[model samples]
Target chain A: MKKLINKPEDVLADALKGVAAAHPELRVDHQHRVIYRAEPKADGKVALISGGGSGHEPLHGGFVGPGMLDAACCGEVFTSPTPDQMVGATTVVDRGAGVLHIVKNYTGDVMNFEMAGELVADSGVRVETIVTDDDVAVEDSTWTAGRRGVGVTVLLEKIVGAAAEEGQDLDAVLALSRRVNGQGRSMGMALTSCTVPAAGKPTFELPEDQMEMGVGIHGEPGRHRVPIAGAAEIAERLVEPVLADLQFGGSPGIVMLSGLGGTPLLELYLLFGEVAPLLEKAGVQVVRSLVGNYITSLDMAGASLTVLKADDELVRLWDAPVRTAGLRWGV
Target chain B: MKKLINKPEDVLADALKGVAAAHPELRVDHQHRVIYRAEPKADGKVALISGGGSGHEPLHGGFVGPGMLDAACCGEVFTSPTPDQMVGATTVVDRGAGVLHIVKNYTGDVMNFEMAGELVADSGVRVETIVTDDDVAVEDSTWTAGRRGVGVTVLLEKIVGAAAEEGQDLDAVLALSRRVNGQGRSMGMALTSCTVPAAGKPTFELPEDQMEMGVGIHGEPGRHRVPIAGAAEIAERLVEPVLADLQFGGSPGIVMLSGLGGTPLLELYLLFGEVAPLLEKAGVQVVRSLVGNYITSLDMAGASLTVLKADDELVRLWDAPVRTAGLRWGV
Candidate 1:
């Protein structure tokens, strides 16, 4: 319960205030709880919108800016945003081209975004949905009906957002989003459970010497609990499943090793050091690598790995200039 | 201790391997444990070199890149790097224009860097040193004789690194580093103690209901322990002393709110939402602000704030393009 918050009820609202205060390039709609770029939307450019719970930061909200998300509908911590919030964001960000809703595979998020797309359809905005289910950890989880969408969502947003930003049509952007999602796989482990602000305690109890391998972003039960192993073994457990899930070889792969909130960069780098060699041995030529806390669960000491098979087009798009609170480069 | 490490003794070396694996832009010398820019040293460009205990990540190692430090000498966790490591890095990065050694005010670090500077002098590489002591926490503490150097070192590196990159002579870069250090002030608080890898336990005991105010970076004793308060009150506690120590008004300022490793970004943003207004109310106009984990203790749950008064030139230098693992923007 040791958190830097005034009250559990106000965490999201107050954090949005902080986001607004920290980044002027971002515009926060306090009423709808959606974060948008402050700059005016370009005519006929495809808009990318995504959101889920509030705990995984720098994901949807922090990604809203130039060359990334057009708007992010933020819900309460580990709670789905209301359809009203999503539709409100869709209506505002819709340009002549169309809108793309980058939905994670969580049941609540998928349903809400789907409802919002239907609600926006009457206005003639061609809203397309791309659900990311890239986590190879589980087929079904506590909050998701399929494999949970985890780190690949961060990668998808960057690659597809770049495509959308370059004035690609909605259909092309949707296809690219699907290709990115299909080619990517993720797996996660938790050294500690994340404490939701409202819950005020850790979501689950993990003994001092144990870890939850293949854990979900919302503290969902993983494949199993096991004795905490060294970084090398942990990297093996994460990478083996991801490589088995797909043939990541024969293409330039973009790899991201993200910290789940509480882990330090020193450790993330240490883990990534082990991960890179494993992926290389498996024949995945890592053309680009990101090792840090990009998408994170609140105060969960763990790490997740995402490997995306990329072609030259996707790599080029990822290399494009992006100006967001999270994932800023080449700008 | 629960950390993503193989062995406590090899954490630094393993993490360096990860640093080398993840970032192709920086070259790591495994033997000397120095992270240097992969590109050759620009002819006559003043080189910036910094190092200290390893736990405060992205401080020295993560800042080594094109527009930042020419090299970073990494030490073992919470242990200052040796004189040989510093001298080795100095010899490699020296380009005949002289070198600037950015040292934090810890006794071990100061002494080691001094010896290394003297060792390099016989080799005819002109070396200038700048010691940053911006912590307003205490006049003197366990590891420091004056104020403990804390968050300002990150800001100093960025500003002064840009100066050196743009061909500023050693004297000019040294003077700018001193100016940044003098103008900046920081105060930190810890919700929990960081566990050093070799120690195999939390550095210090902190109760669930209490927090350490004005805490040092290495889990050293702070001013006092206080009942864990609301974010607003905590922001007031951190900001009041920084403002009282200096007049941050009358000039534009660069403010950075860095999370000590364990605190999540959701809370950091919530904390920054509270911190921004207090700085404004105190007449410090925040021209540019960074709200994330820049400098960190291994896994301590807390944050530190650094406010630096900046003029037009400093802001311009701060905005310069820099590419590194920890901080990347405008490139």
Candidate 2:
């Protein structure tokens, strides 16, 4: 495998070191494998924390900053973080206001965050959890029991993080998180499979002329493999299911077309060129659009589409200042 | 080639459609193929215009926005933009103050931009040209007489763009641009070759167990092919030549490690983790660092590092707000 890494086992540890070195504003807890903002939020503001397996970058760790996540519990590649790490982050970031755990709807992640919340309950810390499951690709996947959370998790964190930074209570943040989760829908396909560092080879074998539609982030089997087609047709495939799954029509919406690690940014924009028109034809009015690699699988050449039906409040919060390595603006 | 494009011939036009569709803040002239700030700069502020072949995305076009570039003329993939396109952009973006044409050191680009400057001289728009040759890879290569202008172009645009935005005159902005180019040095390597759309195949052959060090942005031959090694060893290989060519110790520097389109963000961070310490040990104090795909070669699996020795002025300008599709912060 051609990868810029020293050892497979050291991937997460070494990458965290790089993250700490690159972003001085972020504080990395080496021992616990948690990333935190150097400065804590205000006393009455709700603190946010999220975590998952490592490979999908700029997700939990890169999002740790003032306006997004307070702390991110990082696990090994494609593996869940331990409850102890989550407990440590919850207790540390919590102020007089409560803490919110923004988790994707994966079985291991949900279970671990739930366990951590219970473990921290005796410490007199109020922790509320909002699980996101916006992936319309599949109802159940390799590691998930229900819909797997995908790109909407990034949107939810940005919008809800803004609400929390503006001094919203935990209950209000939780409600907003759910609303964003419910309104957002995502569908992804892969032109190629990602090679997990430990695995040392591609997760799955896709023929040169074939692709996996409705694929999961972890290379889980998609709806089916089909002959590779033009970008316009692929955009229709990704957008049709997402619109069918969620009622995104006749309202202002936020759209994100994220690259799946190995795809070029030029192609992502090309795909979005096709995606935006399709969404509009279906009656979704896109107000804010992000076309880049916000959340990505490791070295997988593909793209995903997420459409979030937003009202004025969601749009305003998304427009608020955010200072994170992954997503930064208005600050 | 398995790119997210409809036809190889239609890549640039289709991607431009996406660029216009995704970013409402930027105005794309489909006919002239120029991306400009939707709202032009004020009359007295000097304007910055940059353009190059298309494959290396987020380079010229993505850098066009406030506090950065006033316009970017896009060419076909890896092909120089026409002289007429450059002439049109120079005349359109020239506020009462002069215009700065930021051209990379490729032969076709340099010649075309120079011709365009001469063509617009009669139009009465004062234009000053700055050709960047910051690659420390080789003294001269296939398409370049001196060094190939690589990642430093991105840094030059950001630092100098801020100067132009703050009302620096054409002469002052041109001086700053030259200073940035002179102080910055870059070295790149590739694990796999990028596939140009029209070529319908990999640009060059890279064996499974070897890598090309000092590789050019367009898959041009590098210094040599070496056995693939660990990240730390590769980091040492990239940093040694850069430090040897220039004295970078004892000053604050802005460092950027850009992916060549195909490497994962996890690996980029991991590689930066290895790169940061090597520079520090060499006495280059990295006051600021950017790790992502700012400049890219379609889908080559590798990275390039650019280090700019910066003083107080350059550092302050670098910290100023920049809001572009590729790089956005401090706003």
How accurate locally is residue B156 in candidate 1, as Cα lDDT from 0 to 100? 91
Task: Assign candidate 2 its CAPRI class.
Answer: high
Candidate 1 lDDT tens digits, A1-331 = 9999999999999999999999999999988899999997789899999998899998889999888999999999999999999989998999878899999999999999999999899988889999999999889888889888889999999999999988899999999999999999999999999999899999999999999999999899999999999999999999999999998877889999999999999999999999999999988888899998888999999999999998899899999999998988988
Q: How many clashes show up in model 1? A: 0
What does candidate 2's lDDT look like per residue over A1-331, in tens digits?
A: 9999999999999999899999999999999999999974678889999999998988889898877999999999999999999999999999979999999999999999999999999999999999999998888889999999999999999999999999899999999999999999999999999999899999999999999999989889889999999999999999999999877779998999999999998999999999999989889998999998888899999999999999999999999999999999987
DockQ of 1: 0.89
lDDT of 1 at A182: 99
- Over B106-177, each residue of candidate 1 has an lDDT whose tens digit, in order, gives 999999999999999999999999999999999999999999998999999999989998999988998899
Worst 10 residues of 2 chain B by lDDT: B39-48
Which portions of model 2 show Cα errors greater than 4 Å?
none
Off by over 4 Å in 1: none
